[model samples]
Target: MGGIGIMIAFFAGILGSLSASDYSQYTYVFCAVLVLTMIGFWDDRKDMRASHKLIGQLFAFFLVVVLGDIRIESFYGFLGIYALPISVSYALSIFMLVGLTNAYNLIDGLDGLAGTLGAISCGFLGVWFMYAGYAVEGIICLGMLGSLMAFLIYNWHPAKVFMGDTGSLPIGCFIAVFALLFIRENGEMHPSAVYKFHAPITAGLSLMVICSYDTLRVFLRRIRRGKSPFTPDKSHVHHFLMRMGHGHDQVAMFLGAIKLLFLGMVIMCSGLNEHLMFPFVVGLTIAFGSLINVVTLKRMRAKVRKSPPISQRYPIKPTATIKSKSTWEDEPVLES
Candidate 1:
């Protein structure tokens, strides 16, 4: 229902001011979102296999990349690479779309987490797009921002409504598109442009650092444990926070602050080259994730140490009479 409301609001917003050519440009995006929304709605009602969901996501992303021509055409000079081969571009675009969509989906574990993060990301992108003179994309980003703000009203701690896969999938995919567009637009900006980013790729990634890093961390941990990467488990960052005694609201706010911090870092470092900024952002994210895990583990161990022994906590009581070997007399037998 939240996802449906977002789509309705987005479409209505676009229909108001966009011309024919603008509508044509976004037709593929609309179609792809519709496909993703349907797939997500279906999965919400009848959980789909991970592989099947991947296939569905691939098809929707293909529409946007191949037909809509909204793909990463370059690496923005990261590692001395600029233009990419067509095949490589298609593959990279699809991988990013799928990865980000699932990353956002995975972070929906806590109330208001996903919606709050989504709003922050979309709001930043919207402001960037408008400042950079991309009205259509700006509208798209703001449309998502508006819906998310509304959704968060009911999705805050003690949530009245959950997004489920129905909202997460499409919302994630849309944010992925915005990130891609941000990278492309930033790269194409004139060198003298006031808002142009020197590290376009890194800037784009900073928008989703938290959830993407969490997803990558969870997948690696699962694989290391000899389990499928998609295997369900309570090993997410949110779960760790919960174990550390943080309430849902605290966890959500803490993560949201971390996300804003990343955005601020990217903005402050906008003049840095991708080579330097990329590694800095990646290192910071890994450090934060590792710190969370270490703190959570220590807290758990401390908790165990503080707890009383189970046998002492639940003492056995004498329930029957038994003969003692030495005394040859009746003695009380204690049963646990």
Candidate 2:
């Protein structure tokens, strides 16, 4: 069900481009990610190996980075890091983009999570592009935002269908490109314009706080468990919520609320004090996430203790016996 919807969205964007006779750098974004969506679709149906999906994702990133020339050229003084050598910047750009793509992919563990979060991210970026007077980028962002919003009508918790890989892969690809463009745009602006108004890098990171941080958390967890980072498990944030007894819709709401709050704080604090904003928000996110984990474990332990024992839950009720008089001897009769 979701595959059909996602395909319709894919074609809608393509046909919209052709109808408008729009051929531009960002348009190639949808075109470049064909490999990713294809591999993702296959994986959904056939359950492809993780290694193969990674290879396909890397190739998609290569298409965007090398051919489309949408690489991040600077950090714009975030961490006091700027003016990287061309070689180093190019390499860093590739690695970050690929990682962002997969990180967004990882957040697709629950209904409406990818769609809700992706719509919010791209919607904010779309408005930013409009503010920056980049009509094409605005169009791309709006297009993606619209498709995701439409998909959510069906993909919402108690979902009629899912976005699957076809939807999630493209979302990750779009957001990664948008984040890079957002950061790169800041570089072209006057330094003081950034200092007084925004911290583009941190703002962009916060736009995706859920995916980026959750991916890092999941990777660290898998590593500590002596498992491959790519190994699938029920350890994602959604799984954690599910284990805590959150219904599917409730988990979606849980994450949607966090995403909104993070985006709001990032937009607000970034303008006031760009220097301290990123780390502060990150610290808060980490703290809140860890608290959730600790609380979940504690509650789980308590719940286990409070629950009825298996034997009691399925008790063998004893039968009543009735004393009976007989000529030969006393007979026992079971009583209903």
Candidate 3:
């Protein structure tokens, strides 16, 4: 599995002390990932309850936060926001982490969907990490990046192997860890890396634009329909694309390509003012949300039009008063 490969790499780093910035803490990361993967594999084998799975995710988040020292300390001055109190940061950190973990898991439906997107997201984040002189985290990112690329070979359309929870859970962990680290202000920015981000948080948002937005879109939709937000359904963004006539590989390609485009834009716009980049990112998210909604509605209408009419479905009977003359009309009967 892809996660298994990354786990080995992390172990190697721990044994060799090859990481910079004390990135050698992959032992903690590896242990945390093993727990997550176990829970995921359990779910794949026996369909674990949503609450239990969430608890596992929380445990993973807690481990990284407490043991790995990976927690939010600042929002990088977004909206003039500065340092958060210890308690508030803990709560906020775990919540964003658990939410994004579930978001990544949710998007892992179709063949190559999660794997391709994971590679893109982590690939760029890894490059940015090394670019900014964060080698250990960058290595972890690239570890995940390489693992996911290897995964896509078998996970492509007509997938020969599947990630299931075994892969999805840790991939989410990687994204959360890297994205949060990406947004953290580690004193001053490296000169070469400065132009790679306007506000580092925007890069995080852009890297995960589709997954984050689609997760929000589905949650709101389920709640609006009076269903639990965790209820599973075929209403994901990929489902919408499938309804629009795309196959597994095609949908994955389009979505991944789009995400890659936004990521490139994020890098390009990194030189712009944070104030400008923030709005640009938010506006793009809003636009994507609106577009998906319209597409969902269109898919619904198309489905309705394709369905048989009620009378045709039921085969409504003619009135007895007018049917007495025919041999088949003397008695009321249901049609199969």
248, model 3: CA deviation in Å? 0.5
lDDT of 3 at 15: 44
Best by TM-score: 1
Worst 10 residues of 2 by lDDT: 326-335
* Candidate 3 residue-pair clash tally: 0
TM-score, each model?
0.90, 0.86, 0.83
List where candidate 2 sits over 4 angstroms from the true fold.
1-4, 10-22, 191-197, 272-274, 314-336
> Per-residue lDDT for 1-336 in model 2, tens only?
364576577457856754454545455676756666788789888988878887887778877777777887776676777788877877888898888888988899888888888888989888878777777777777777888888889888678888788767766887888888887786667656633236777777777789988899999999999998888888888888888888887888888899888877776665654577767887899998998899889888888999999999899876765455552255444446
- Report the Cα lDDT for residue 287, model 1: 91
lDDT of 1: 0.88
Write one digit per residue (lDDT tens) for candidate 3, span 110-192: 99999888899888877877877777777777767776777788889898888888778877877877787777733236536
Return model 2's CA RMSD, one decimal: 6.5
Task: State the number of backbone clashes in model 2.
Answer: 0
For every candidate in turn, the CA RMSD to the true structure comes to: 5.4, 6.5, 5.6
Q: Provide the lDDT at 282 for model 2.
A: 77
